[model samples]
Target chain A: MDNFEQFFTENRLKLDVEPLPEGFNNQMIANFRAVRRKKQTIRLFAAAGFLLLLVPGIMLLQPFFKPEPVALQESPSSAELSILTRLQPYQTEIESSTQFISQQRVPTEYSVQFQDFLIQLQIIDRQQDIYQKQIDSYGYTEDMIQQIMYNYELKLMVLQKLQTEILKINKLSKTTNHEYTNIQLEI
Target chain B: MLGNRQDAEDVLQDAMIQAYTNLKSLKSVESFGPWMKRIVINQCLHFIRGRLNFADLQLVNTPGESDETDYYQFSMEELNSTIQQLPDGCRIVFNLYLLENYSHKEVAEMLGISESTSKSQYQRARQLLQHQLKKKMNHG
Candidate 1:
């Protein structure tokens, strides 16, 4: 060991910890408490924020999230107007996507599935037209709006199912055509 | 390793707070001293990481006397104050290696420096400390 190392080792016990500043203990305690309190306040705020979001989210989605349909007897209300306003976009979306489907070429003849999709679409369309006439006559009762939204949603679902089937058939047709090309090349 | 007195005290207090909160995770009470030291040292290392530039410590010459009594006359407080006055890089390397008994490898890994750099800084520390002590001795 060097002279300094030797010196330090010899004086190790005599080497004092730095003399504490004035009121060091009191300062430590106060700072510790402040830090802990700050942490708890932050945690409380986080939980409060989460609950604040959750309650309104549940309220706004409550109607759509209902497992069983509510009986359509409520009088026309602002809430119904808001729901109808929100649903207007969905109505446009369904109509446009439905139109887009006719523009797409049918990749295969899934006769039974295609027939079922057509039948369901026709029935929902007929029901929606009836609801529209009733709303026109009665000035949009809550029940009429709900029925119209329900018909639109059902039609969108059937169209989505038919579109998925068509996509699957398209993929199968592409793979089969590739195999046929390989066979022709070999021959 | 933070040169400022108040900053060092603040780091020490934060380390204490960390140790107090995580005390339950300690496996044994006997190991508390080293564990607490680890916390404080970690806090200090974190504080100095942004400040210490390892590239600046070019060791000029080796330090030490053949006689083991060269610094025997100096008080521990005097030695400590001199150490405190050291440049941030070597002071930290010295504290970790000599005082804390960390291996050169461990010191390097802890300080995010190469082992050779750790050794060079340490040698620089020794040279600087010896220079200061020699000045003190001549004055006294």
Candidate 2:
């Protein structure tokens, strides 16, 4: 190299690479964590809000979920009431699982498909309720109790299937749009 | 270019944050070093542009400046201090073109100035540095 180039090269070599300011890396990591926490808080509030809207709607629609008491001549036995109480936990699980599935971010094309899946789950829930009402009316026979439990399992399975489908779609989208990989890394 | 260590640090921090946020958009990991340097340079330019009006960069005329022989007489420390004293526009063009090995065209594109402007700024920087170095040598 000529003296002009050599002069610059010597100067460049002499220039020191400055050390990062004290606590800078820690500060940066903290900022990133704070941003991530804010996003999680927002998501939590949204999920809570959705549950708030859903619970009251379900309560208002209680009549549709039950057969009229006048239709049954005999009062339900303790055994039938116990069966109803046992099913409550499964019902709560299904509701929360459905909520989780609906909260996922999906493409526009899959939204209609997701809606269809939800409708199918609702149909299954109504079927379970119908079988539950039959147990109250005809007395809790072994066969009737088994049918109700079967429908409960079916609802849970459908919810699990929907969750799996949502996860698959999320993975596919992340692969296609490379920027989404950063979000996944943050999570 | 930023003239002080504090301003340089601040710009570095901001550039690092931006780079981390957009890291996933980078296609190859091998390009990370150059990518980050570009981000830092851009941040420094942005900070300078925001604080200093371009129209205020007074064009200096230093006719009969000392020849290249004066630069050979000075120590590296003297050369460095003289570079640090250059005006912002001249300093930036000098650093990018000479030290950083960026072509005038690339420096112009990076700084959003015309190619001719980059060349003139570089020439002006060299002239000023040569003059300052000669003065220091004569005094010392």
Candidate 3:
């Protein structure tokens, strides 16, 4: 753009170069190392963060990792004997009700409801088994016996409610009232 | 704008530290030279603006001759000696537009000056450098 720029261009290499301060290069090397160390520290922290997060993640997935079920005693021991005897009738009733509900060719809507109740009943059965193991391990209290009896009764109640609802729905819906009326669920 | 060798050295060191810290953000190794030059320019601008208000510089009429990107490029040592001879506003505009190949608009934004102010200050810088160089050529 100007003769002055031509002079600058011609003398570019000849132009005095600014000398870096004494020890400046070495100081920069030291800083680079420090920065590298800091980056590594940040990476380590991130890894530690991920591992800590996995602790809760694994805990949340704990139900899927249930331990192998322990086999029940061949014969009931004296400690659990009294409670098991009291629970037998309700247990038989629950088994028969479950089979009857499953065999029923109910419409899909009531079938979905029955399946939900059945899953709940299975969860109660598992709970009762847990209390029985506790009785075996630490001996039974009246509380343990009462809880097992309560679980069985709850299952029967669920089955009865389902049966009553289906019967009521069959009566109200004109499609085929006599078809559902012919079937009776054993409590 | 940062007068004196001690201050210049300090800026250089600080600029090196800044570039080193953000090296990971640099996209290419080959561009390190220009990228570093840009950083140093920014640091110098920051150093100058900290003490001097850029808005205070007076603008003039008529724009200066615009130089090409590679035309006025020079070494930092040459710039250090050359630009310091200029006043605050002209020194920064000259350094950015001439030595570093920045456009007048870029210089304006960097210095918080109007584009017209950048151009005029550059014109003044061009006039001053021409006078100074001619004096040196004839006298020295």
Q: How would you order the candidates by DockQ, starting with the best?
A: 1, 2, 3
Tens-place lDDT per residue, model 3, B1-140, is 46666888899899988988787876765565577778887888888887775654578664455443332444446445665777777876776776666898998888887888888888888777656645554564
> In DockQ, how does model 1 score against the reference complex?
0.16
- Backbone clashes for every candidate come to 0, 0, 0
In angstroms, how far off is B112's CA in candidate 2?
2.7
lDDT of each residue in A1-187, candidate 3, tens digit only: 5666665555544443554577754575566668889989999999999999999999999768643223325544653566667778988997887776656545544455456765776787789889878766655566666777788788789888876766666555557544432333322
- DockQ of predictions, in order shown: 0.16, 0.15, 0.09
- Which parts of model 1 have CA positions greater than 4 angstroms off? A17-187, B57-69
TM-score of chain B of each: 0.86, 0.84, 0.75
TM agreement with the true structure for every prediction: 0.47, 0.50, 0.47
Q: Per-residue lDDT of A1-187 in model 2, one digit per residue for the tens? A: 5565676777685654454577754575566567768878999999999999999999999767753342234655655567667777887988798678656667665565567667877798788778767756655666665677788788888788888877887777768744442211100
RMSD of each: 17.3, 21.3, 13.4
User: Which digits, one per residue and each the tens of the lDDT, describe model 1 over residues B5-80?
Assistant: 7998899888887777875566764565577679889988987788778665554456544544466577777877
Taken over the whole model, the C-alpha lDDT of each candidate is 0.72, 0.72, 0.68
Query: What TM-score does structure 2 among the candidates reach?
Result: 0.50
Clashing pairs in 1: none
In the range B1-140, model 2's lDDT, one tens digit per residue, is: 57798998899899978876775565665565577678788888888877655652444454544355635566666677778899878888889998878998998898778887787788788887767766776788
